[model samples]
Target: ADRPLLHGVSLRAAAGQTIAIVGQTGSGKSSLAQLVNRSYDASAGRVLVDGVDVRDWSLDALRSQIGKIEQDIFLFSRTIAENIAFGKPQAPRAEIEQAARDAQAHDFICEQKDGYDTVVGERGVTLSGGQRQRIALARAFLSNPRILILDDATSAIDSATEDDIQRALRRVQRGRTTILITHRLAQIRWADTIVVLDKGRVVAAGGHAELLRSSVHYRRIFSRFDAALPPAEPALAAA
Candidate 1:
């Protein structure tokens, strides 16, 4: 049974702005991201990039212009340098190192047995979840795409690691559009605009404070996140 994943969901993002999509599980957040990079073509309506239809662009050209990192990161069984240079194979070593630094991955990578030359096991099995994510981020940063999509990319990471990654993401997001599909309150708070999805539809859209005031659905979701936060920190109330 093929049901519509998104229904009449209309939204827009300005260049260099961050847009966060927040929702409960099965809310179609990932589906929306997939459509942006053309991983899944929309069954109806259209996706536009730079005011142009995504379908009109060549697949390679379209994908090359977008850098996407999902929760399930996939890294090859190769040296750290090789993996980072996957998108730009001819990139100089200096450029690769710069990208690693930008991803907050350089320090750990340098500590590895052979530094950047260390060969990872199949699917990066030798690396921890957080390390693999940083490597994936470094790969995306090396690509230097105009648009970045992060689909819960930091969910598996601990708070400290996620903070480092978020800082790196802030630097990489400059002069580019960023879409964050996540339920983490911290990540959602970073967006210039937050879109709330429920059952494949946009239930609300606005800034964090504005939605907190007007949308009960959003407040309810935030309440759950609030309850999970440390008692010393007044989560959404302070936001």
Candidate 2:
């Protein structure tokens, strides 16, 4: 069955700004992200990019400038270098290596017996979650997207590998507009603006600090996140 998940949802991110969308599991966070690159078109209103309606842009043209990373990274049974260069097959080895380095994947890739020449199992079965994410990041870097979308991209990995992915993300995010959907407080706090959704509608939109002070929904979500962390993990805020 199909249903509309969002109602009159309106928001904007300035060029090079990072906007995070946060909400409960069914609050339409991912659905809203799906509209960005036009995975599904709005039934009514328009989605604009660079002042042009996304519907007006060719899919290939529109998608080429947008990169996305999700919780489950997909990779083919190809050489490591080939996987990283998937978006830009003509990319030279040096550029591929540079992208991997920027993604914090170079050293680890080198550790493989055949290094960049190693062929990963289907869907990257041979790689760790963090490794696959880093490879995805390397692919994104090579593609050089003008806009990047990350949907809980770090939520599944261990904290240690998460640190590496986060570092690579910071490097890759420069000079691009980023739409982030994450539960991690670390990722949420870095956004230029955080939009809180409740039951498919935006309940609040503001800086993290501002929302914490004024939006009950935001505070509730934050507290829930805080409570879910391990005992040793620092609270997102005081009780």
Candidate 3:
């Protein structure tokens, strides 16, 4: 029998808003993101995009309008330009360069043996994890989808590299709906809304301050990472 991953989870985000999803290891966070792109059809509830049920839209048309960056990046054995251009095969060279620049990958890419023409090995095995992620980000940036979903996309990157990517993401997120699934408190703090999930259900929904003050589930999760967080909000003391 197929076990349900999420149960009665309903959430909403306005256009151009950023929503961060957080939970424990088995909390179905990634599964929730997958549903946005119809990666796995939900057995019960429906997923809507721009007021239309996603299932009703043509699969290619639906996916082409959404950009997804995951923790595990896949890069074909091709030149950096080719990979970035995969988003829009006929994209101009200048556009691909600009996307790399936006993704903070231009500098390193330029230093490569043949710059954009440098061919990578299978799955980007020749590049560092952070480098591969930046390439993936560049591809997404080139796509410029209406909705963006980031599922622990920066987990493999170091703190410094992650900071750079976050800066790039802030710029790309403008005017587009963004859904972030992450464990990083810093990333979570930037979201316009934060959703706390537990056992496939949304246990709490609000901004960082509000969740800290009202949700015990949130507080407990935060407590585990307290040292990494900034000063505890005074409101949390009374929660």
Best of the candidates, lDDT:
2
* Residues 183-236, model 3: lDDT tens digits: 778888889999999999999999998887777778777778667644445553
Per-model clash counts, in order, read 0, 0, 0
lDDT of each: 0.88, 0.90, 0.89
Worst 10 residues of 3 by lDDT: 230-239
Q: Which ten contiguous residues of candidate 1 have the minimum total lDDT? A: 229-238
Best by TM-score: 3
| Count of backbone collisions within predicted model 1 | 0
Give candidate 3's whole-model lDDT.
Answer: 0.89
TM-scores, in order shown?
0.92, 0.93, 0.94
Model 2: number of backbone collisions: 0
Q: Rank by TM-score, highest first.
A: 3, 2, 1
Looking at model 2, which ten-residue stretch has the lowest summed lDDT? Answer: 227-236
RMSD of 1: 4.0
How would you order the candidates by lDDT, starting with the best?
2, 3, 1
- Per-residue lDDT for 1-239 in model 2, tens only? 87789988999889999999999889999999898899999998888899899999999999999999999998999999999999999999999999999999999999998999999999999999889999999999999999999998887577778888888998888889999998888888889999999988989999987877777777777778887532333345766
Candidate 1: residue pairs that collide? none
Model 1 lDDT tens row, 3-120: 9988999999999899999888898999999999898798789999999999999999999999988888888899999999988999999999999999999999999999999999
